[model samples]
Target: MSKRVLDVGNCGPDFSSIKAFLTKNFDCTLDQAHGMEDSLAALREGNFDLVLINRKLDRDYSDGIEILREIKADAVLKDIPVMLITNHAEHQDAAMELGAKRGFGKLEFGNPETLEKLQPILG
Candidate 1:
């Protein structure tokens, strides 16, 4: 079965790279959302196996943590696995503290460790 992923707040090039990497490595499909409202709406309407939220939205420079928080707080959406895409350990820790899975940065997109982290979810 192909998994479905919602990628939130990523810019065009980033989303393209992510989509390519995921498609090449796993049986999955990726969808994009530019900000919190869009992300939440997509999550509510779709069956996504995982969510990848950018640390700062390219669209408005809004904090992606707020989006993560929203998802984690909702009863129905809270169970869906979420990962914050960032290079900063502090930000990663913050997301993890709020129930997000450890996410990889854009710089680490093609790393083996990233594949390892995603395997259980997307494999």
Candidate 2:
């Protein structure tokens, strides 16, 4: 069966790149949300195997950490695995501290290590 992933806060090109990469490597479907509200609503309404949140939202350039916090704080959504898409180690560390899995950077999107990092969740 195909896994479902929720991709939050990415712009058009970024989202397209993520969708293409995921579809190519795994049996999965990708859905996107541009900000906090839509992301939360989509999580509540759909069943997802993983969530990829951008470090900075494309729509308003708002912090995506807030969205991550909200998900971790919500009882219903807390268990779903989340990964923050960023290139900075500090940000990645922060997300993991809040219960997210290790995420990959957009700069390393097609790297072999990125795919390996995603294996446990999407494999």
Residue-by-residue lDDT tens digits, candidate 1, 16-92: 99999999999999999998888999999999999999999999999999999999999999999999999999999
Model 2 residue runs over 4 Å out of place are: none
Question: Roughly what TM-score does model 2 have, to 2 decimal places?
Answer: 0.98
lDDT string, candidate 2, 1-123, tens digits: 899999999999999999999999999999999999999999999999999999999999999999999999999999999999999999999999999999989999769999998889889
User: What is the model-wide C-alpha lDDT for candidate 2?
Assistant: 0.95
Q: Report how far residue 37 has shifted in candidate 1, in Å.
A: 1.1
Question: Please, what is the whole-model Cα lDDT of each candidate in the order they appear?
Answer: 0.95, 0.95
C-alpha-based local distance difference test score of model 1? 0.95
Candidate 1 — which residues are off by over 4 angstroms?
none
* Cα TM-score of candidate 1: 0.98
Name the top lDDT candidate: 2
